[model samples]
Target: MTDRDRRNLLERRQRAAAEFVAWSDHHAQEQRHHEVLLAQLETHPDQLDGRNAMAQQRAWAQRDQHRRHLHDSALAQLRHAFR
Candidate 1:
């Protein structure tokens, strides 16, 4: 590969890696927050706030899945380019 092509591939890989890490971090944070909310829902004595947490959990899960798909696709593309 030409130097320019190699450099572009490297840059794309780095960007993809960085984006994956960021999305992962956000997902983790969101999961943790959901856990805390769920825990509170279980532990608290307030019957009024007995809202279902599954909806939020499912939303975050879907978001994470989408992010993972994008990250995987990017890495796969980079790998193909490098080969």
Candidate 2:
């Protein structure tokens, strides 16, 4: 790729990395809030995707996985750009 194109890719990835960091921080806060809420509703857990804790945990796991996917995709693209 041309120098300008590489520079642009670098800039875009930098912004994406920064945004990812912010999203992670925000997600952590939201996770904590949900944890608290779950604790408060120990008897029910509010039917998140199901009627039990396992279902809710699975759903949350998927959400976390998606965040990881975003990070991984950015890293892979950055690696490809340098090649």
In model 2, pairs of residues that clash are none
The 10-residue segment of model 1 with minimum total lDDT is: 47-56
Estimate the overall C-alpha local distance difference test score of candidate 1: 0.67
User: Please, what are the lDDT tens digits per residue for candidate 1 over residues 24-75?
Assistant: 7876876786678667656766555435455555665776687577667756
Clashes of each: 0, 0
Model 1 CA RMSD to the hidden true structure, in angstroms: 4.2
lDDT of each: 0.67, 0.68
Instruction: Estimate the TM-score of every prediction.
Output: 0.57, 0.51
Candidate 1 off by > 4 Å: 48-83
Model 2 stretches astray by more than 4 angstroms = 43-83
lDDT of 2 by residue, 1-83 (tens): 99998899788778767766766686687678668656755666365635557765666677667767766775676566455
